[model samples]
Target: MTGQGSHPRHGLVDVIHAPVRLSIVAALAGLEKAEFRFLRDTIEVSDSLLSKHLTTLEAAGYVQIVKAGTGRRPRTWVSLTPAGRTAFDAYTESLKKIIDAGN
Candidate 1:
């Protein structure tokens, strides 16, 4: 019998557990950086919703948000941090373990 009592899913990072946040992380994982509007469109969330989730991910050190451009047009960019990538890798491994457990 296993000594550990907790499920592998318990190892999931709470910050990235939410659907929207998870989507954000997953999307960022494949790209060096993406514009905020592109992410919002890809994730199918409103600007405010994306901003809210980005704030949470930023607070958790899982994402970096940058604002650029000048004049009438400014752009926001988002990317996963090194720490975020590490955490996401671990989270996916935990999910794999969970799937294996069910098999």
Candidate 2:
């Protein structure tokens, strides 16, 4: 698990391993989706930084981003993909296994 190393095989999602990315994933785990402003504020990350992380997550097919609104500018909404939820679930399980290994 996440004890002394990191990797998918080690129960860690590399793309989501960074502190910020991990926090992003964790934050999105409980919601159907979160708006950009809400996520930025909650994660305490700058717009650029959050954009970068979102891009990474999107590239991995772990997150879905959509734009919608009734104006010239559309609001951004992001949520975990099915694959993402599955991955997160597996990661948590693996982490638990590691903790239980010595018990």
Question: Which prediction has the highest TM-score against the true structure?
Answer: 1
lDDT of 1 at 83: 96
- The lDDT of model 1 is 0.95
Q: Please provide, for model 2 over 17-85, each residue's C-alpha lDDT reduced to its tens digit, 9 standing for 90 to 100.
A: 788888888899999999998999998999999999999999999999998995887799999999988
Off by over 4 Å in 2: 1-9
Question: Whose lDDT is greatest here?
Answer: 1
lDDT of 1 by residue, 1-103 (tens): 2755578987799999999999999999999999998999999999999999999999999999999997789999999999999999999999999999999
User: What local distance difference test score does each model get?
Assistant: 0.95, 0.87
- The segments of candidate 1 whose C-alpha lies over 4 angstroms from its true place after superposition are 1-4
What's the C-alpha lDDT at position 32 in model 2? 99
